[model samples]
Structure formats: C-alpha cells, structure tokens
Target: MDSFPPALLAFNLLLYLFTYVAATDSLTAQDPYLKDGFSLVSSNGNFELGFFSPGLSRDRYLGIWFKNRRGPTSVWVANRNTPINDSSGVLVMNITTGNLTLYSHDSTAIVWSARLLRKIPNGVLQLLDTGNLVLRDRKDENPLNYSWQSFDYPTDTLLPGMKLGWDLRNNINRRLDAWKNPNDPSPGNLSWRMELHEYPESVMWKGSQEYFRHGPWNGVRVTSRPLGIAPILNFNFVSNEDEVYYQYSVPNKSHTVMVVMNQSNYLRIMYLWSATERQWRLYTSLPRDFCDNYALCGPYGYCDIRVTPSCKCLEGFKPRSPDSWTAGEFADGCERNKLINCGDEVGFAPLNQLKLPDTKRTWVNKSMDLEECKQKCLSNCSCMAYANTNISGSGSGCALWIGDLIDLKLIPDAGQDLYVKMLASELVKRGEVQKTDRLKPKMKISLAVIAPSLGLAILFIGLYIFKKRSTVKDDHEKIEAQDLELPLFDLSLINSATNNFSIDNKLGEGGFGPVYKLDIVFGKHRANGLGAEGQTNIFEALE
Candidate 1:
C-alpha cells in the first residue's frame, strides 16, 4: 500500500471535521449528564448555560444566558436568592434525598438547594436545547420522575415550554418575577402572575396595585390582549386528571422565546436568533401604548391610542366633568346620558374590535352558547357584557363580565366581538344628536382647525423654550473649552504643507477636511552634533 502525502492527509482531516459538525446537528437530548459547572452546548452552539459571576460581584451564580445574547440576557436564574460568595459553589445532586444542591468547593456549605421528598436511584442534571434544565433519573428515559427542575420556579423570563399557572395536584403556583436590575438577578418590585380568582387572567402588578391586565382567556387567546394569540404563539390551558396549569410556546419549535417581566413591570417577549440577526430582539411588549394602563379612561370610558387625546367616553355617556376633561384630567370618567332601566327596554350595542375587560369578578361557562350567554346577561341586569370563550369552530363557551370594564385594548385581527348593554332611548338620542351636529359645516371646520392649530402652537412653543434653556452660561463654557483645544487651520497653510496638496501626498478626506502627509526635515544633521534630526515637523491639524 502507498502512504498518502502530507497535503492529501490534511485534506482528509478537513473533510472529517465537516462530517462531524453535520452529525452533531441532528443530536437532541442524546446525552445523560451535564457535569457541575459544565454545559452541553446547543447543537448549533448558539447557547451555553453553566455558572457565571455577574458584574463586579465575585459571587458565583448559576444562570442560563444567551451564548450570543446581547450583553448578558439571562433567561433563567437558579438560586437567585442565594448567590455563592466565591468560586467555591458546586451544583450536585444528592443520592440520599434525590435533591439538587449547591455546595462549596470543599463541600462544606449548602448554599442553595432544590428540595425533593423522595429518593431516586441515580440522577443527573441535563440542559436541553430548549433552555430547560432538568434533573433526570438514570433508571428511566422518561422525565416524569425528575427530582427538581427550574421550570417549577421561574425568575423573570418565561421560556416557551414552561407552565405559568397553578398545579392543583401539588398546590404549586408558577409565576414570573422581575429581576432587581440588568446586572443583578434578585427579585424586584414587579411580578406577573396568572390569577385564577373568578376567571383566569394574566396580570402585571407593581406591589399591591395592578398595573396592566390581559383580560380573561377566551379559549384561543386572552380577550384583552389578542396579540398574545398570534401565529407564532400557542397558548395551552390544561385542566386534566393530573395537572391544572397554563403554558405557552412559540409555534416554531426550533426557535426559543422568553416572555419576561422586565424590571419596569412591563411584559416583554424576546425571540432568539437563527441566522439573520445573531441577537435577541424584543418581539412584543404589554402596555405598549398609553391605553394599556389600568382603568386609564375610567368607568364607562375607553382609551384609544389612535386618538390624539387617547381617552374618550362610550357613545351613550358624557364626561362627568367637562372642565376636568379639558384640563387633561379624566379621573371622574363618564356618566350615562340616561339611566339603565334593567328590562327589555335596554338595547345591546355591538362593540366591535375590542379586548374584553378584566374578569376578576366574572363568570365562565364552557358549555354555554352565544345565544344562551346573551339571555343570561339579559336576565341579570348586572351583567354588563358577554362574549364567547372559544371563538373557533362556531364558538363553544361563555365569559361574562359583571363589574366595570378595566384594561381594555383595541386590536384589529385578534379581538373578540363584545356586546355591551345600554338603554335604547339613550342610543336613539345619541344618533339623532350626531346627525344634527354633522349638518353644521362651519362648526365642524372650526373644531378641526382650531384644536389642531392650538396643539401645533403649543408644541412649537415648548420646543423653543427647551432650546432657550439648554443654551445657558454653563453649557457655553464647555463648548468654548472644546473649541479652544482643537486648533483651526487655513486652506493656504495646508496647501503649502504638501506642495499644493499633491495626489501622492494626500491621505484621505473625511467629514472634516482633506489630510496631507508631509515630509519636512527639521534641521541640518551635518555630522558635528547638529541636534541629529532636530525636532521632526510633527504638527498636525484639521482644516
């Protein structure tokens, strides 16, 4: 047999490398263990999770941050409440209790732990490509017997496969809490939880007060924030014999999503990259506009971001205080033009393209049809509105609202049609008044021009005042110093410096001016210590 040359051998090695990469790409959950402080790189090597120290702190923390995430975007944090003071932290599973514990380098301190009541024969923690960290039992390939997992306790980020509701069997409530800051993984003031009070609603809160709500679940999506039901997202509500929990995931299984409660109490969804932009981009955010604030338009009123003022009363209602509304204060909300008569005398107005209101004090019937729901609301005068829970396949369930509407958002494609009850006489009066007002062309034009012109004038005046205040004495001092430090050069001196700035000597012209490279001898170095090359002509300036 003839031996291959060196170049031929190198070519064969390069071919083997490509084949190895291709083979690794197809592997998934094929490994049994990810050792302590070591990570199993994603098949694509786009993400890695082990342990890292954040910022200037020496404390070691176990977290799963994006391998290419823009500047430390940690999706999940383990032991956030207990950060190891040094590199002594080691994550290991105990065989006796079947618990996952964080210990010191010398195995002295148990800094943090995931408590498990039962003992497992053998266990090892594994990091799945989906960014899920699970403690798996070696005896069985099934994950049903895991000792402890990060999905049970979430930090700020909501990954695609994680559940977000209560587990009735174990009485465990899964919720996402915001981090203290970008650098610190401590719990913060903001928290997002799926409330199952009367109806299941996802809400963000700043301490005790509710900040924004995503209405009630209408089977397919949350009625208030229909964007949550986009094609990329799949909301799952499971109440079965074993578990009762709500989980959501991005439809594209290959991609990873993290819906996080940001430090500011805003719900944000970030999508991991594939090839386009190698960074996580913010895909969606709640309270995206002013209208998303809790009860911004008050009772009987609705907030519309499309409008300049963004607050308006319903058709059959008028501002409670005209003066307060004009002054940009709307706490008083709106009052009914006529009282509700509670009988067949009431007429239902179809509020199209709207997010159903908060359902904290509401009722839901899975078997009720639309006609049945309407009759139920009609019978009880307190039922302000009614809508279908599942809006697919001719609709199947009913969600009824009893209290004032709160945190309603208007969406185009995903919103459910809401039927609001109002007095027939009030509706007729409003229609007639609108017809009468439309006939007055002069009044209509005046309102259109005067209001817009006033707004423009105010905007221009505010800009002028800001410019005036910005150019004070203190600001001028900094500008003056910066100008003095930069030497100003004339075109003539620059021309002479490079023989009329010849093409050969010309460097490059940028935003400032053309720069020319000059070669000028300082002094005559005629042997007898004539100060060698004296001082080279090293002066430089921008003209």
Candidate 2:
C-alpha cells in the first residue's frame, strides 16, 4: 500500500466521522459520548440528533430534528431553559447507569439529565423514526416495557403518535406548553392540557385562566373543532380509569403533520408539511372568533360571535356590572334578576345549545340521571346550576355547580343544556313556572311570625333612643331627644322591651354602642328572655 500523508489521513477520518453519524441509531454505555461535531440518526434515517443553535441565538441546545433538515424545524429539545454557551457540549449515557446527560465543555457540568427512574443493564438510548427518544433494554423493543422515554415530556410541537394528556398513575402530565419566543424554547404563558373534570375536555390556558377550549371530545369530534376526519389524518382519544389523553396519528407515514401552540399569538396551529411547497402549510388555527376566547361573555353570559355585540346576559339574569359589560369587558359576568330562595320557590331555567360552564367548583355524580341531577340541585341551597355530564347517550351522569357559572356560550347544534337555578318568578317569564301552591305553607308561617315581630322591633328602637339620651352625662354630649319615627316610651315600657338591656338581651357591641334585642329570637313569647344563648341568630346592624 502507498504511504498516505498526515493531511490526507486527517481528511478521511473527518469524512468517516460524518458518515458514521448518518448511519448510527442506538447509543450504549460503551459509546457514551456523541460530541458537538457528531450526530445520532434514527434507525430509519428519518430523524437526527445533535447540538444546534436556534435562530440567531448564540446559545446551543441538544435537540432532535428531521433528517437533512436545516432551520425552522426541531421536534424536541432537552436543555431548552439552560442552553449551552458554546459548541463544546457533548451527550453522554453513563456506563454504570442508563442515564442520558448533556455536558458542557471539558465534561465539567451537566446541561441536562434524563434522570431515568429504573437502571437497565445493557440499555440503549435509541431515537425511533416516530420521533420518540426512548431509553429501553436492547432485548426489549416494546415501547410499554421502556424504563424511560422523551414522549412523556413534550415541547411546543405535538407530533404524530405523541400523547397530549395525563398519566395519573405516574403523576406525569403529558401536555404541550409554548416557547417563550421564536428563538427561545423555554416554556411560555400559554399551555394545552386535558381538563380532566366531570367531563374530560382539552383546554388551552394563558396562565391560570382558560384562554380557549377545543370543546369537550364528543364521540364524533371536539364539539367545536371544525376539522373532520380525512384520509391523511387520524384522531384518537383514550380515557380509562387511570389515564386520559388525546393523540393524533397519521396513518400514512408519508403525510407529515403536527400541532403547534404558536407562542406569538397563542393559537393552536395545525400544520401539514407539503413536499410540493417544500414547507409547512397551515391546516387550521383555533379561537377563530372572539366567541372562541374562554369566558368571552363572562359568568352566566352567553356569547354569539355571529351577533354584532356578542356578550349578552342569560335569561332571568342581568350583567353584574352593566358599565364594564357594555364596554366589551364582560368578565364580571351576570347576576340573578330574582334571587332563588331554595325549596319550591325555585325552578330551573333550562338554557339549551350552549357551551357548559367551568367545572372547577363542580360536583359530579356519575350514576345520577338528568332529572336526579335537578332534584339534587334543588335540595342544596348552595347549588347554583346543574348539567348532564355526558350528552352522547340520553345524558347519563350529573354535574352540579356550587358557585358562579362562567365561560358559557351558544354553539348551535353543539354543547349540552345547562339548567340554571332561578326563582319561580324569574322562571315564569321563560315559561318554566313551577307550582306556586307548594310555597303557600312556608309563606303563611313566615307572615304569622313576622307581624308581632315587626311591632316588637318598633318598641325596641324606642328603648335604644331613650337609653342613649338618658346615658349622655357629659356636658358636651348632652343632646336633645327628637320625637321622630317611634312612639314615646315610658321607663317601664322601655325596660320591658329590652329586658333592662341585660346580658341576656345584649345582641353585640360595635363602634357606636352595644345592641340589645327585645326577645327577637323567641319572638313575641314570654317577658322573661329564655332559650336565647350564644350569639343571637338575629343579625342587626344598628346605626
């Protein structure tokens, strides 16, 4: 063989290093390091792994991207928040433990670590063509048998076969959160998560508040999503007792598609890669209208984006703050026109064909029917509303609300009916009037108790005035008594009314003076104040 020069030998070695990266897939303990210049390719040569700088940023990130691709496309990132300052970073899978770590220059500090739960002997870190970077045993290629995987953790992009939901058993929340900016891959304010409530729904949140909801996943599709099943796209939702998630897969691998929660506009943009166009084409973007915004119409307010002024209070209710509501800020929501008094005085005003309210303060009884749910709401004075949890098959299950109803909107041919608790008088206007005869007995008893109580209340006020005038001893405090509302009271009459302002009659004390009751609780009973213990149930704010 002819003697090769040192320069020619060096060139051949560099060419071999580059070629080796394009062919290799699995990285084991023996081959622990993949340096900055080297890359890891998927078994099918579909995806590539390397340290790359995003956009104009000087900081480098350890990421996996489409093979032969350049900028504007990286699927997943490991050290997104903590970027490597230079290109001297290296990926290392420890020999003793099957742990993957990205290291800075000179292998001094770790930029990121996988922190695998179980150590697998002779384990391999393989980048699958499906874009899942998993740590599994070489003998077991089964995805379920894997000890650790990158699919559990996600970035802005949700790829095919990637789950967007929860793993309750492991407390792993598989959700998509947006990047801080175009260049920065750090988590932003917007997030996409499955709201596993009485009815499991996919909602996008801006911070803690709901920004948008895909509507709940009905049997057909997300109730509000305009997208339909097509030849290229396949949608799936799996919700058992343990885990609940929404996964999308492309049956034809040739068709490229992904859902990106756009950081700039907080829009969940579905994109399909067009080989013809040589770029990603926008399939759809959600929150297409002002009505799509979470709680766009506020509490008990129904929004109709088709209407010019969409925000309008529900029947039997009015805007809590009309001024703010009219100004296009309907967040204050609406309050009842007639406050419900529980029992027979209340009837349900059934609002149909609308998005249901937020379920944070909701109580669910899966076994209860719609009628049973209505009865349960009526029994509890705190319950403000109730709705069917499942509307697919005759609506089985109950969802009861204890507080304000919010984020409701009109979606024609979509959403379930919400039966709001309202006074019978309010319900009458909506033709939902209940039997008023059931309320007559309570009304009669209330009036009989109130008549004598009103006369005693007048007498008690007279005593307080006399006591104030007589007790004023200081020269500066000496004030004339004005004969205004109440009839004059003798000392005997005043003493009889207040029980001599005794400890038994002492209602409570405030900044003005101590308040005394005139047998108010025992109402028109014996002169002796009996059965009145602890603080009186009678709440009086005396002037």
Candidate 3:
C-alpha cells in the first residue's frame, strides 16, 4: 500500500482524535453526542451516558448506566417513554434554548428535552459517579448546584445520595416510579414518594391509593422500623422551608446498594451486591407482611402478627360491625365501646411497641417533652393519641394525633409507644383488669397446694368414723336402723355453698375433724354442715 502524504496524514489523525474525544468526553454546546457508538463516561469511570436499547428491546433510549458492569444496569433514562425505532439519535445542547435536547430519527422531531429557566450560553452535560446526569454552566465551579439533573426525575432505581422528595421552591417532586416491566422503561403505577402532611412521611402508592408507608421520621429513623445499624448505611431525612427529602448512602465503597420499586410484585426492595455470591442479595423490602398493608386493621385497631386473627381493637374500642369483624373483614374498623365525655376527667392509656398511627391530622413540637405532649392532646377534644417524636436518649419532642387513629401495627422490637386517650373510668377498669391478670398465676399455684391437703383431711376423718361405728356394740347405743329417717343432701350442693370447703370458710379444727361454717340459706331454711369424722352431718334450721 502507498503511504499518504504528510499533510493528508496529519489531517486524518486529527479527525480520529476528535472522534475519540467526542465519544468519551462530556458534551458541550459545541460537541454533540451522536448515536453511532458515541457516548459520555463519568470522570471516575463508574457511570456512562449513551443511547441504547434495554434488554432485548429494539427501541433505543438515552440513558445512564454502570460503565464496566457485566450487564446493562440503567439508572436514569432521558427518553424512556419515547424511544427511537431506528439508530438515528443525537443528544445535544441547544445554543438558543440552553437546554439538553434529544432528537430521534430526524432533527426536527424532539424525543425528550430538559429545560432550564435561565439560558446558559456555555452549557455542559456531564454524568457523575453517583449516577446523576446533570447539565450545568461550564463557568460554574460548584458541583452541588445544577441547572438540570436526572436525580430530580428518577425512574425505578434510587441510587445513593439521590434526593427522594420535593423541591418546594420550584414545586418539583422527586420520586421513584417503577418501570412497566423488565424490558420496558415506561413509568408504572407503583410509585414511592415523600408525602407532604403536617408530619411528613415516605409513602408508597399504588396509583391514587396508599399501599404502604415508612412512618414519619422520628429524629433517629423512620418510625416504622430501623433501616440498619450504622457504619454500613447512613440514612438522612431533611424537612424545612425550601426542601424535604430522604436519602441513604453506603459508607463503605465496597458495598453496593440500590433501592428499587419493583412493579412486578408492587414491592419496594433494597438490594446489596454480594461479592461472594456475585449477585444482588435482598437486603430489605417494604410491605414485609400482611400487616404491612395500609390500614389493614382499619381505624382504632392494630395488627399483631404474633396473635391469632392479627387484627384487634384497641383498649376501650370494639369492632364497628361485630358480624363483619368475626368474618375476618376488618375494613369496618372499630368504634369506641364507651363514648368519651370531653368535659369529664380523662387519662391516657399507653400502648407499647407499636408503629405509630397515620399522621394526616397531626401536630409536632420538636422542643416539647412527652408530658407536655400528653397535656396538649388532653386539651384538644379531637386529639386521640400522643407520643414522643424522638425516642433517642431520654426522648424529646412531641407528636399529637387528631381524629381517628389509623394504620396501627405491633412492631415489637423497633416500635414506639403511643398514649391513647381514654375516660378516667375506663382507665380505672383497665388497671383493675391488669391487676387481676397478674394475680391469676398465683391463684392457680395456691389452689394446687391446698386442694390435696383438704382431700387427705376428709379421708382421715372417714377412717375414724368407720372405726367408731364398728366398736359401738351396746343395744341402746345402736339406734334401730329400720326407724332412722334423715334427709340426704347432694354433695355438689354442699360443696357449692361452702365454696368447695375453702380454707377461708373454715371455722376451727374439732376432735372429729376440721369444721366448716356454711350459713347458706336454701329457700326458708338455713343449712349448716359439720365434718364430724367424715360423716358430714347437715342440720337445717329456719333463720
């Protein structure tokens, strides 16, 4: 082959270098990323932004994924809903609009575009190691702020450090929506978002209805359960004037973790990549059991998995519909057994190891103590329960719930205590019931020890009476058996009146045997029973 001239060869080498730079480097206003093998890789080489088809899909999408992973793991997709049928796609920064636009098949048709309020003359689109694809002004030195970012519009997976909440100032809600299916990148009905209420909480929705909730943040963690111990993962939640968001991070770089809202089973799952297993192992999942279903036990009721028929009414409450409740249908919930008198004396009944009720109608005071919380709840007729907002250390902050309490669950080890409001009379009755319950075991033990002793005493008296009867030989001492007439009393009736000859009713021990005083009145007659050497003699007399 003939060698090219020096001038022509130099020009050809420059063209190859330009092509190589465009494929791997960030996309600037001047450099457009083409669909034909061109891509952008993060500086740390952890993430890549490119145009590709997901799974066996022939449709192409602009997305970000792990750079050197075994299989394609797309974290964020730009044109997920709209895909290019052919490979003619280009991602470029429009100079006039100062926005990142994706064009598919034709230059006139726009597939998906990200807009910025203020136009930047020198805009640059870059992919970060944390899997965030951002468009920022080239002159800006701060990496924290971005004109537009993929983290603000997450798809199925919630990568580490990505905010999953609202930007109040801009009215932007950042939430995770699951894909339609394994092969499709379209948005699904299942979504996980931070709900904005008096007390905000992270909730998962199945379309318009609530499916599950990771209870409100309680200064430590979400009140529903502990995410995990420290050192492995650190979860942060912030709520203020401008923004409210929840984010989690793995402290150790060796550990790879991601949260995905799976559409197939409608589950929010956290997966940790296990190096030993060479696969993603399930770390945790929400809606863990049947009790995790939102409002499964309805209002004023709680679900305890340890008990049979998990749904149970709270103290002072009864099933709203007894027939329905007995049929295992808890949707009707529960109603107060005794209605509360708002002006009358009232107190709080503590329910322990419980996942706090829904906070739709709630009030919180970060500086108030638990006693203050109780007083506040008591003062408000609508307030049904109160609890310490933070259970760390001695516990501070107050959370009061108004209206009917819903979605209560028994969390056992990782649950908070809720003080439910009750009438003073009900409180006293509950106290007495508890006292009786505590004494039941002791009562059983006493009966076990005393019953045998009483039986032996009766047996010994019977033997003495038999010997006395055998020794009686005088004709006048032995009464004529034919003329003797005595009314026989049922043993059961005698036992009932003397309370089974309880030790409490025992008078004193006589020469014959132990005597029991039975002042039981039968009709117009009073009967007294004496254990005279096992020949229990009953004497009836009018009172």
Cα lDDT, all candidates: 0.70, 0.79, 0.83
Q: Order of all candidates by TM-score, from best down to worst?
A: 3, 2, 1
RMSD of each: 36.3, 23.7, 13.0
Worst 10 residues of 1 by lDDT: 524-533
TM-score: model 1 vs. ground truth? 0.68
lDDT of 2 by residue, 177-207 (tens): 8888878888999999998876687899999
lDDT of 1 by residue, 166-280 (tens): 7666667788888787667888878877787656777788878888877666667666655544467777776544555667777776666667777744555555554567666
**RMSD after Cα superposition, model 3:** 13.0
TM-score, prediction 2: 0.73
lDDT of 3 by residue, 32-97 (tens): 555645777877777887888887888888888776565326788888899888888887787655
Cα deviation of 363, candidate 3, in Å: 2.2
Cα-lDDT of candidate 1: 0.70
The TM-score values for the models, in the order shown, are 0.68, 0.73, 0.77
Q: Name model 2 segments beyond 4 Å from true.
A: 1-10, 68-71, 195-200, 218-220, 226-232, 239-241, 424-428, 432-543
Poorest 10 consecutive residues of model 3 by lDDT?
A: 531-540
